[model samples]
Target: MGYKLNIHDPQDPTSLPPSTRSRLASGRRASESIRVGIPLDYNIATLQPSVRNAWIRTLKALHANGHTLHPVRLPATQRALSAYYVLAPAEASSNLAKYDGVRFGSRAEGIDGTPESVLFAKTRGQGFGPEVQRRILLGAFSLSAQAIDNYFIQAQKVRRLVQQDFDKVFAKQNPLLDDIAETEGTGDKVDVLLCPTAPSTAPLLSKVEAQDPIQAYMNDVFTVPASLAGLPAISVPVPSATEDQNIENEEYTPFAGVGIQIIGQYGDDKLVLDYAKELQAVARDS
Candidate 1:
């Protein structure tokens, strides 16, 4: 809430002179009360009770503020999560390839004059941690000649579907379209979509360590769809009503806040931030 900023386009040098820090130090609210969609059915089954309660409270706050809310579904969300795992690791594998001993990152010793393959392997093995290594290997496997079409190609298609699903819901058409729609904010479609940022509040460190890799990945279930679509999204923390005030003697206490996410269409970054500012105000006033 204390932040101030300005929007600048790097591609357009004219937009760069007014630095973000020089802008007026005040948050802007949406000029009009627009329809908001809440994907109530999106991954609700696996949502933690505390997170679910937090979402419900936020929903009530939004309704009380004179904004319209509706229930909508994006059928591709689950598929998008699977696609993200495939696509992200594949990208990481290719992008991180430059960090070999010869050019980037920390180089391993005792490998001077070795074959390029051995040098690269030793450097990556010594430099990358377990998670990065796993993703790199997964990406490499997905990009392999035999598997590229089956995994990477399919993931790309799913990513397209994720984008299309978002496009279908937002009232404002994606600016990337060849024929941009002239009329915006004038339809039955939602101006923004609201949902939980994660499936749960912060986890106990012990539980985090105990989670298997796939289980850990499931934590991103609610977030990856918007990411794959390249939409502008923000997560605002909403205080949970389930805090245990009497748990002072407990060895571990639950975190009392969960983030609720707001997602808007492509080129709608301003709209997303505007809505986020309003949501933050709602949270504070509550």
Candidate 2:
């Protein structure tokens, strides 16, 4: 998906770094650069109708406005998905352990002779989905004393590496970076990074359920890296021009406009939204 960058308004209430007032007072130019980062794997034909139209509109807008976009293809995005599933659930299991009946949840009443309480198992089994169950199991295994260092610890490292990969590719430096020296001369380090919000637009709930579990997992791959890094990101709908497309065609099918995501480094939340609004305007004009 193509993204247009535009100047941000300092008057908005959700803005960050009150320094925006100082910058405005200092009379610094408010023009922010725009760049679209389309994934190498993006196939226009596979998008839902509404999403496809939006992407087309965004591209047309950027072209008409003389805006240039940079393409970013991360070959490791697939691996990152795998790593996230393993790591996220493992972490969830650790974080969620505190919710046992004794600690912080509704307790089941029928407990007596069993070595393992049926009540706890029943509560969890009914509360979590299959995917959640799988993750919890994996997490439980990983956190066992024998597996802690090898599985849970290594997954944490992979998660860090994923964040580092993003930090390397985007034009902007991560505001959370402790050593600014490492990000020097990184080419304008863009005010925002643009990308496809999902691997594809939202699939029909039935179609999504029928697909392989792994495929469902891949849906979040594009959004995960940003989430892992604690960055600010927004998904904006890009509308298509026409409505006659087929409802079943996975690619080129008209549905909703593709969600083009805008991500910003920590503390640059206002900058991100300001630019998003600018892109929205650009999309409308185009």
TM-score of every model?
0.84, 0.73
- The 10-residue segment of model 1 with minimum total lDDT is 19-28
- Cα-based lDDT at residue 226, candidate 2: 73
Give the C-alpha miss distance for residue 187 in model 2, angstroms.
Answer: 4.0
lDDT score of residue 86 within candidate 1: 97
Q: Write the per-residue lDDT of candidate 1 for residues 1-286, one digit (tens) a residue.
A: 6754456666776453454324323422587787889875574687877677678788889989999887777887879879999999999999999998678788778754355456467778888999999999999999999999999999999999888888877776675655554555555588899899988777778877877999889889989999999888999988766453342422235555788999988767778898899999998877
Q: For candidate 1, what is the lDDT?
A: 0.80
Cα lDDT tens digits for candidate 2, 1-286: 9764434456755554445333322211236335555555444344445554566567667656655666555554546666676678878898777666767766655652256664477666656778878888888888889988987777677778767766666665555455466655755334456666774666676786698977777678778877766677998766555552544555444454567888765655676777677778876665
Q: What C-alpha lDDT, on a 0 to 100 scale, does residue 12 get in candidate 2?
A: 58
Whole-structure CA lDDT of model 2:
0.64
